[model samples]
Target: MDELSWFRVLNPNSKNPDGHARSYEIVNQNYANKTIAEFTPHISFTNYRACQEYATANLNAGCPGKSVLDYVEEDTLELTDPVAWVNVGFHHTDKDEDQSPMPIHWQKFQIVPRDFFAQKPTITEARSCVNGPTGGAVNSTTRPCIATNTELPTVSTDTEDPTTGTTLTATPGAWNEARTTWNYQYLWFRDGEPITSLDEEGNEVGATGETYVLTAADLGSDITVKVTASRTGYPSGTAESEAVAVSGGAEPEPEPEPEPEPGAVTSKVKASATKVKAGKKPTVTVTVNATGVTPTGKVTVTHKGKLVGSGKLKNGTVKFKLKAFSKKGKYQVAVSYGGSGKVLGSSKTITVKVKKK
Candidate 1:
């Protein structure tokens, strides 16, 4: 048999037993008799039942004299049971007389390798420590120090400028000083180990600025910053700045814009009224006078606080008719232009009084 060839066994009663009808192939095959190398079989009830029934019925029908019987006995028959008479009623008593034979046969070998075991590495175990902060006098040999759980030591040095009235203070977080060169402004760490990368606080070993403009997204509680400073012609120094608490610094967001007021002026809308019968409709010619602020949107006309009609502003004014306002007392005419999120001009309220016909 190959490494993992599939095979099926005929054992109807064997389904109740473990590995009775399963197919398996040789995995090791290193034994002298190749017994230990043979892989275990996987037994399924359906296959076992069908195969055992077929083999039993064939044996019972006196069909052993045929070539099929010889092949089954030679290839599938167990040494303990020469006749290989499997009790069909072992698991299921209601055996079908018309049960068909399973064409699939159990093979001794397979082509694929067996999958059993594999491991992965964690982040801390995989990272390596690089060169980091060292402590010593200027021009003296400095020993490499691994960043541990302790807070980074502070390095400080100061110089008084005779020309300037200010005394220059240089901490580990300070940048401009008497030093020649610096790796970065701040120190980073992973699992208490000093990292040669920049820290989240922007303080490495030589960082300095009056005000750090950190992004709003980076503002959070427990955020810390370490300062490193160095100056030309002076010994370099490092210092841990006081941690800035973001909890108290957050501010409220601004309010949204309000809706535009009604009766706002857009382009000019000419107004004209004609007298008519009591029941008749009165034509109100609203000639958009001058294109005031040329409205870029739809114009709405209101009469006596009710929206009488609305139309797109074409050539500045739109002509509309009002039936209810034809015969009325006093009518308030208002023209509003502008949609949401936009501001348009507003006209003074126009009053029109209608007399009875």
Candidate 2:
């Protein structure tokens, strides 16, 4: 629609250019036949009377010198699946003259599909890349939107040993780096349930910050934290860390052990005396240690691949008296530990000197 027409042209000095003086017109259009040009195009879109109520696909039925709208008659309500041609355009003010056909002038227009297909056509483009490629459907050019988790977030804790009365700090996973640009929230869970506790004034409340102190109520319960990440134009995303168990005034127990590995235990063997009289038993002390926890089981002393003495591990250590030696000489004694399900076995050797009696 041109606003500068001779009759209905609007005055830009008094009001904004073509300040929407008229409403748009919707003419009946159809797929069965071609749409004839309007008898006389108007700045205000007024001319034909037949289009007042209906349009026909038959171009042969139109009369000479009559607009397509004039040829069509109104009151045709039986027409199914009616098509509508909506008029849409804007007024472009003319600029200074240009003789050498300046670069193509730009105009605003859109021809988009609406509800023509079961699903949006752009979905095909997004589906092509969502799960990698399939049969060369890769879209190299710009595809429509594909919503997915762009940022990964995870819950982090301050201490590995979760014990009663220990303060635990958690850092919610990251979304956008700037906290002011987006929103983030934290929720603590106990055994899959939201954790709730009392405030200083004895009012009950839920955890909201990055730090939570363990209490007696948390004893022996699995604790986990969920971090929700949010940013403008992105769907909210949440991630949770593996659970951490709180102990009752004791160090938290280690998780179930994987298949045992070799050399998980270290052992030292010591003798009470380096030299002794023949037929005198020597005290052999063996100590075994596993990091951070006491190891249980037994230790055996062997001489020349033969069993000499064996004792059970008590507090990760044990002592055994070697049977008296009949001959006088230096004897190589070997101390070995039969490991437990949690740790591998260990072996070490010591020397014992015996003198003739």
Candidate 3:
């Protein structure tokens, strides 16, 4: 059986001199140790030399006065190969709950990530999507900056026996959320197209947890399903199951990969005002035009190499409302198109003048 475990992250820029940024600890306990040893043997070591001597020491007499933690606190000696030890022991008090057939117990350790990232790793930029410089330009509604959950959920499919199976069923694992509850939506697919379930009245409905009965038309296809989980305020997440082939059906044909498009898409950025007073918000729009294809990707704006804003492209452009500048100066604003699979990337730089507040 697999054990359940989690880890923690630490800030790398922490001022602690020990540089104890990250550490992973694993502790395993054996109940037999309590009975066989004098001091209830605990794994402890100072350095490579002490570890060598301790391993050779007789089990009859465990380290009498030197625990690994003790050595760490007391000894200032530097070591070439240092080792830290941790102990996991089940605690018991003289209470009624300490019966013979004990309830499930756990012995665990922690893995810490110290000073891992300079900032919150998942932060996203604030920006808005608009059609153009028309009525929707300044009035565009900004999409809330929500991070997509990339952790795939677990799904299993059951089809009874291989010979006579005509129906397949799928089950989804619980979506675990820390601060809120998760609601789930499921979708079923044959090959790559969607499949829907029908209610008793024959009205189409969601295919969540529904059985998929095989038909003559679906004889050569494989079946798969996907589940999306979302909370009221949090971003939504999606996960898909591995495709399950029909019992005695022809193998599904694989879809061909699209070839990479030839020419690169170009980007041009224009600000609403060439000059604006400090603390005044200005809108910047990036137009990504291709000769023969529509560009689909994100546009990122940087001011003197610092990321200012970013947004996704709709139609052929992405718009960003620049935050107010606190200081007045001439700034170089650069916009880059992070091109999609069918489009190559391009960038453009422009200058914006900011006056005194």
Candidate 4:
């Protein structure tokens, strides 16, 4: 599951001399084929073009040779409800240590939410230092600067996700005194810095207006509006609104649960006593093991297809105090494991003879 951590982005892979460079593929699903060579680069019988960086246009329509950032800008992300087909894997080479009695190697990667929650999801009241503070009094009681004659402008947005080109509105507050020529000048900010964007002519200019439309540049940044209220008789009184986060991304889904593969099941059965009194029950233990997985599901003691008794498996085994044999004769009992998804069921049989009391 993707979640926000203190470390959101990874530093340059080459920053660490010992670290291997990580690769990413964000495209269509026809990228992989398992029938051929191991980690094969599919060239033949494929029309897909290799991806390149910072391309102005998609030269190859069959398979655009653009990097993920370019692909997101020009094609896949333009329309709403779009999907980015991302595939991740680590290909390793066999070393001397990877031979028989080899040391197991594991690789891990994370895909976390970019901007899904309003606040940090890990924050809680139990953690008093959530924002890095203790419940103690401070030496200086600092407060916001306010004036009786001047009121701060309230900033609001149609949507937090600035990627949609939503409108940002700054309503003028009640400025009672020195009302005449109370000119309001607006300047947008991103993380406390004046926000600048390029026009159609590609010129940098400050975003200044009572109502401004959010640009793609505003995405994944903290946005705020600073409004300066001025009049002929009074000095300019500037007040800024609270900053809002524009991390316009969706919540990530959790990984699916793991289950054992079929055709590797090994079932076994053991009885406390093969011969028991007619009225006494037989203690039957059923064990079902699989390669690389622990068996879990229903374990049953049966006669032919008829279930004698059913029990749940725990830690790959289950014990059943089966119904006592009535007649004085040798009989067969089958112990079965009702399998789970992708896991084939298995059964074992044992002999139990009933003796007269």
State the C-alpha lDDT per candidate. 0.36, 0.53, 0.54, 0.54
Output the better candidate (2/4) by TM-score. 2
Task: Assess candidate 3 and give its lDDT.
Answer: 0.54
Better of 1 and 3 by TM-score: 3
Model 3, 1-357: lDDT tens digits are 224433333334453333456443344443313543433444444565333233223232334444444455555775546554444554455557667666676766655544444334554332221212323222112233232343443434453432333666655554543334566676876554576668999998755664555666555444666777665434565666655554455433423323455654443433332467553555677778776778777777777655656778899877766644534688788877767667767787777777763
Model 2 Cα displacement at 246 (Å)? 0.4
Tens-place lDDT digits, model 1, residues 1-357: 323224233434434222344332323222122232111222112212223334223444434423323334345533443222221111123346535753343323233322211111231311211112323323222221212112333322232211112222323433332213444355422111232326788755532433233333323222233445443222344544332323222433323323656754334445665654332345565544433344444555566554554555565566666533323366677756433223443444555555553
Per-residue accuracy of model 4 over 1-357 as CA lDDT, tens digit each: 222222232223333222433333222212333433322322112112244322234456643654444444455322433333332333456888677887775533345543333336565422212233324432211211122224556778766455547787886665543223457788987655688878999999999998877776666455667777764323455666655666654322322333556554543443333567543466677777776677677776767654556677788777767655534577787776667764567767778777753
Model 1 scores a C-alpha lDDT of: 0.36
Off by over 4 Å in 4: 1-150, 160-162, 178-181, 199-203, 249-357
Candidate 4, clashing residue pairs?
none
Segments of candidate 3 deviating more than 4 angstroms: 1-151, 154-167, 174-176, 197-206, 250-357
- In TM-score terms, candidate 3 sits at 0.26
Clashes of each: 53, 0, 7, 0
